[model samples]
Target: MINACLLNDDDTLKLVSVAAGSTLPTNTIWLDVNQPDDEERQWLEKLLIEDVPDEDEMDDIESSSRFRVGPDGVHILSLFPQRLANDTRGVNMSFTMRKNLLLSFREDDVSIVRLLRYYIRHGKANIRSALDILLSLQDLKVDQLSDMIEDAYSTLDETADTIIEEGHVEENLEELVRQEELNGQILQALYDSRRALRFIKKTFESSLDDRQNRNIDEMLNDIESILPHTQFLANKINFQLEATMGYTNHKQNKIIKIFSVAAVVFMPPTWIASLYGMNFKFMPELDWRFGYPLSICMMILSAGATYLFFRKKGWL
Candidate 1:
């Protein structure tokens, strides 16, 4: 859907829905395009007098392709993590800023954009220009990212608690690994947000006035502060993974020790039986019934002696 938010003379926001083949109002200051159809896209392109990036262009990762400043405006494409009911994934969003107009393009609906619109309509935000709107959006994004990191920290704490209270990790190894993977994902997302904030600061630092520059600076600082917390959580998760692996190896070694001791205890009996079973007609002991009983007794005595030696040495 295409939405045009127009700033009125009374310092209020008026939103208009731009449908296919409909005329875009000339008074629009902010144009938001969400999953635009071909016709809608064409209409927006014609209205802006500049090219609008499609999904593929927005998804490009190259710095040159993602960020560019032309005579028309400054275009920036960034990735932001989107969280639904129980799932989280990244979304590509494109922004274009001209003299007094701002255009944002997204293939999926973003709650941030919706909240911005709601605040503007309800007179809760003191938005005067497209720049103010952009700053507001950035502030909202920073707040959300902070919340995400906080939630991840809480989850890590809970996992750590589970490990401590259980006193063992054998049954929950898989769960621990899964949680570690999740923390890794959250860390990456946090870094992505940090990069976006830095890019925005660099792009506008020279062009914006003092007030806007300070706002951007503050946003950058907020992001920088949160980075360490995410990194700490990632490290803690990795430590948990290593601890779990160590416990598993300990159990395996204990089993191997038992098998080794059993093999050593039976070795003597096997040697004695093998020597007596070697038959030769010249062997006088083989001809006597008493020799057979004596050989059996010797084999039992050897095995018992080996067992006693092992126990004495604490190998058992």
Candidate 2:
């Protein structure tokens, strides 16, 4: 779908749905193309005078391909955080910023885009030009990353408490793994945002005014501040995982130790029984009546002695 954000006469933004055959409005400051169909893609290509990158191209990891400055405008393919039903992931979106228009193309819906659209429609966003829209989107993305980090922190704290209390070791490990994955996603998003912003700053250094530069600088600083937390969380997750595994191994070893002690305590009784079971005619126990009772007593005393020895040495 293609939605155009037009700047009205009163400085407010109006979101208009651009139909397949419709021409883009002259006052449109931002053109958001989400999972565009073939017709929509052709319309956008004709309108922007450039071909839109496909999903595969947008997923490119090379910085040179991801960020480029050409005669047409600046092109940036940046990763954004997308929340799934059961988890979170990073989605790459292509941004093309021209003199008067900011075009964003994404294969899937991004939370930041939805949020920026809502803010613009609700008069909560202060957007003067296409650049403002881009900066605002980045700013909102940073805010979202911050919120995600805070949530990760809270989750880790709870997991740590559970570990310390020794409650549900398996569940705690699973939660920690999830948190690690989430934290890694957050870190990737932050790194992508920082790199995109840095590229924007360098590309538009001569064109950007004081306010835009300041916004970019602030976002960069925020990213820098939040990076350490991700590292800390990564380290904490690793430590907790190791500790949990150790605890699990300790429990397993205890069970094995019990079985080992039981085997050792019965060894002496087994030896006595084996000796009495011999079928040799010359065996002294076969001719005597008290032989069977004496063998039983000997077996009991040997087993008892083994048990006492183990208990005395604290092996029980």
Candidate 3:
């Protein structure tokens, strides 16, 4: 789908749905192309007079390919955070910025885009140029990343409490693993955003006005502040993982210790019983009247002594 965002004379934003073969409005400031079909892609290519990056190209990780200057504009392929039902992941989105036009290409629906659109439609966003839209998206992305980091912090705190209390160690470990993955994605998104911002700053330093420069600086600072939290969370997650595993091992060893003590406690009684059960006709104990009671008493005494010995040695 292709949505064109146009700025009105009254400084309000209008969202237009550009169908295949339809000419984009001349006043459009931003063109958002999401999972375009073949016809839409053709229409976009025709409108922009250049080919859009495909899914594979957008997924490229090489810095040279991901960030570049071309005849079309400043091309940037950056990772954005996408929330799943149980976890978060990074989704790559391509951006091409011209002096008066900004185009975004993505295969997935990112919340940042939706939120930016909503803000624009509601007159909550102050967008003066295409570069402003790009900066606004980056700003919103940093806010979302901060929110995600806060959530990860809360989750880790709860997981730590669960681990320390020894409640559901297995479940907590699993949750920590998932949290680790989410934190990793957040870190990746932050790094990508920083790199993209730095590239834009360097490439457009001469063109950026005071406001845009300050915006970029603030975002860089925000990213710097949020980065340490991610590292702390990563370390905390690892520590919790190890702690959970140790707790599990301690519980398992306790169980094994009980079995070991029990086995040792019963060994003497078992041996005595086996000796008495031997069917030799010349066995002296069989001829004694009180032999059965004597053997039973001995078995009980032996078991008791073994148990007491264990207790005395503090191995129980």
Q: Which lDDT value does model 3 have at 45?
A: 84
Worst 10 residues of 3 by lDDT: 161-170
Cα lDDT of model 2 by residue, 1-316, tens digit: 9899999888989999988779778999998889999988887777665688899999999998899986668999888888886489889989899887999999998988988888887899988999898889889989999998888888878877777455679898888888889998998989999999999899889989999999999999999999999999999999888888888898889999989988887898899899888787799778899988998898889889988998999987
Query: Highest lDDT among the candidates is held by which one?
Result: 3
lDDT rank, highest first? 3, 2, 1
- True-vs-predicted CA distance for residue 183, candidate 1, Å: 5.0
lDDT of 1 by residue, 193-232 (tens): 6666677678777667877777878887887887787678
Q: 160-258, model 3: which lDDT tens digit per residue? A: 777857457778978998998898899888999999999999999998999999999999999999999998998999999998888888988999999
Provide C-alpha RMSD values for all models, in order: 3.6, 1.6, 1.5
- Against the reference, the lDDT scores of all candidates come to 0.76, 0.88, 0.90
lDDT for model 1: 0.76
